[model samples]
Target: MSVDTAAIRRIAKLARIHVEEEALPGLAAEFNGILQWIEQLQQVDTSGVEPMAGGGATALRWRADEVTDGAQAERVLANAPEREGEYFSVPKVVE
Candidate 1:
């Protein structure tokens, strides 16, 4: 796909970039070059290439799934300026 100066201006506007009128031609040429390179890449054949998960074949380690209180009540509420028993107290907003 060939890119023109008008297309470059539209792209700049969509990206919210402040590109000058003089720079549009140069930018359009650069964009067209990139598209040409991508088209060249598309011509390569990779029929049966298996995708790789990572650089190595190491298995990831996982911990047991369990739920527990994040902290003891006193420790959890220690920094509360105004707390009611085991919870932080806030001003009631509802009527």
Candidate 2:
């Protein structure tokens, strides 16, 4: 697929990018080159290739299951709007 200046302008407008009139041709040409490269890549032969999981045959690394955030009560409530001791003192919403 060819990328024309009009298509580039429309894409830029949709992406919230401000493309000047003179720069539209350059951007369009660049996009056309990228599309051409993608087309060329699609022409490669991968019929006999097997898709790998996680891009390899390696097993997933596991970590120890442990509590990591129970000792930071004061730090966690440091920036609270209103805090009492190590906890946040919120106003009673229901009477």
Candidate 3:
């Protein structure tokens, strides 16, 4: 893949990066080198390689799924200036 200065300019615009006009040629050449390296990587043989998880062969530990309330509502509502039943109450500011 050939990366010309015009393509580099377009890429910079899309990525919201500021590139000096004189630096476009250098950036284009760098991008072309990267694309060529990626193309080379695509030609490698991976048919015999097995997919592996990032955590390796070990099974991950998992905790039991349980449901229960935190049961601290009274403690949480202790600092309220005004509360109606179980909720905080605020002055009405609109009709």
lDDT of 1 by residue, 1-95 (tens): 89999999999999999999999999999999999999999998866765576535657789888897766999979998899999999999999
Model 3, backbone clash pairs (residues 3+ apart or across chains), number = 0
Which pairs, if any, clash in model 2?
Answer: none
- For model 3, the stretches where C-alpha displacement exceeds 4 angstroms are 54-62, 67-95
Model 3 agreement with the true structure over 25-87: per-residue lDDT tens digits: 999889999999999999999887866866447687898888865687788779999888778
Which candidate, 1 or 3, has the higher lDDT? 1
How close is every model to the real structure, measured as TM-score?
0.58, 0.58, 0.57
CA lDDT, every model vs. true structure = 0.89, 0.89, 0.88
- Cα lDDT of model 1 overall? 0.89
In model 1, the runs with Cα more than 4 Å from the true position are 54-63, 66-95
Worst 10 residues of 2 by lDDT: 50-59
